[model samples]
Target: MERIQEALAKARAQRQQGSATRTEHAAPPKINPSVDDAWGALSPFKLNRALLKSHRVVAAETGRDAAPYDLLRTKIIHQAQMNNWRRVAIVSPDMGAGKSTTVANLAFSFERQRDMRVLCIDLDLRRPSLHKVLGQKSDHSMSDVLNGHVRFSEHGLRLGERVAFGLNNGPAPNPSELLLSQAARDTLEGIEQDYAPNLTLFDISPLNASDDNIAFLQNVDCAIIIAAAETTPIKRIDQAERQVAELTNVMGIVLNKCRYISDNDGYDYY
Candidate 1:
């Protein structure tokens, strides 16, 4: 909490200093929010296209998977516009439901859209995977930011022009406390104000596995439940749906790892 307070104060002081100095200093070369800062300074490493393809990251080059991500993007945009939502939590009923992969693909897909800003944060404190998924390994992440180890700007990884990611790698002893703390909420709000991303994707832990998703969803706009094709049981899905609905808007369910069958009628998703 003290770290968050100091960050807030530092931000305020910087703003005040900027206003006072004005024409004399010429704003000390502002950090361009539009593009990657430099090589290895503030910008994150560029995602390897080949590695991403192997991981089944949905991109424009991906023939079959692109359509689903495109449709998902459309639906997400429509819902966001309809409900005036800017933040969404991507969660699953249990582990191995492809929640992290879904978030990675969605963020990558959003990058292709013109004028769309997306900030993808790995809030799965128990097992932070975005760093590895995005190929942007970082020593610091949202855990550090929330704990006041670093500020958002200093720790954020800018991938493309429109996409920025805050990733975590280490597990905190008290994961729920980090997400539910006032400092966590304020840190998110600060990042929102600084970056002003159109869509903020919070990749959270499984809803049934722990109370992290429910508690964290209280700080976001909506949630999308991810269910594996055959592994996820109906009762677990129903339970997760009901529980999430009570906390935030159940945006929609993503059926990941679904098989596709092709016949004379072309392709049919089962």
Candidate 2:
């Protein structure tokens, strides 16, 4: 115990000295930048590394032709190019299916892998959770934009070096009614214009034939439906695919929260 105490004291003294030296040499602190501003200002190098690891894990489990995120990124960009689509919507069969998680990761992957300016707009409205998933505040949401209460440039939430996201905590009056408003159209248009050649992902509600997903689909370039493992039935997946088909171009389906084993038979993913 005496030896341990001495070692601890020495370590603490060294740390304090180092910290003092650093502080003395450190430059003055800069202004606290807004979320979107910070995102746009920072480069995507560091975030890309984290995304690469995620892709490797996913690819390993799916047995897909390409690397995990690389495969998805390539597919998404290809779809965008083929259809001249800039907006992508990530939806699910229902709530609690990891759609927001997938959207956040996908946005990160796109920015990291494709080197494109990516923005994810959470239009879930009724049940907004993208902020929680991304560890961001939900005070400012897409609801503000849809209601013409806030400007897009002001409310966009930055997620990383170059990724920004927006949230909507259900628009005024009724979300369904707001979905059809001209303000919604203008907001989408503004985003497309400002983030030119950028990829935008809309995290929207489930499609139950005549739900908001149908209307939301009209604004995006393509849509990806998320289905939870075991929780989502093939019938619903089929229905989702079919419903998205009613639109011009549909991206595909994401099997969310999948479990996988490594080639060495080790478990992963916490």
Residues 195-229 of candidate 1 have per-residue lDDT tens digits of: 66677889999876666765576555678999998
| Among all candidates shown, the one with the greatest lDDT | 1
Query: Which 10-residue window of candidate 1 scores lowest in summed lDDT?
Result: 20-29
**Cα lDDT over the full model 1:** 0.73
Which candidate number maximizes TM-score?
A: 1
**Model 1 segments more than 4 A misplaced:** 1-42, 60-62, 262-270
Per-residue lDDT of 122-194 in model 2, one digit per residue for the tens? Answer: 8877777766655454456777777877876677755445567776544434666577566797777656555
Which parts of model 2 have CA positions greater than 4 angstroms off? 1-67, 169-173, 262-270
User: What is the C-alpha local distance difference test score of candidate 2?
Assistant: 0.62
TM-score of each: 0.81, 0.70
**Candidate models: Cα lDDT each:** 0.73, 0.62
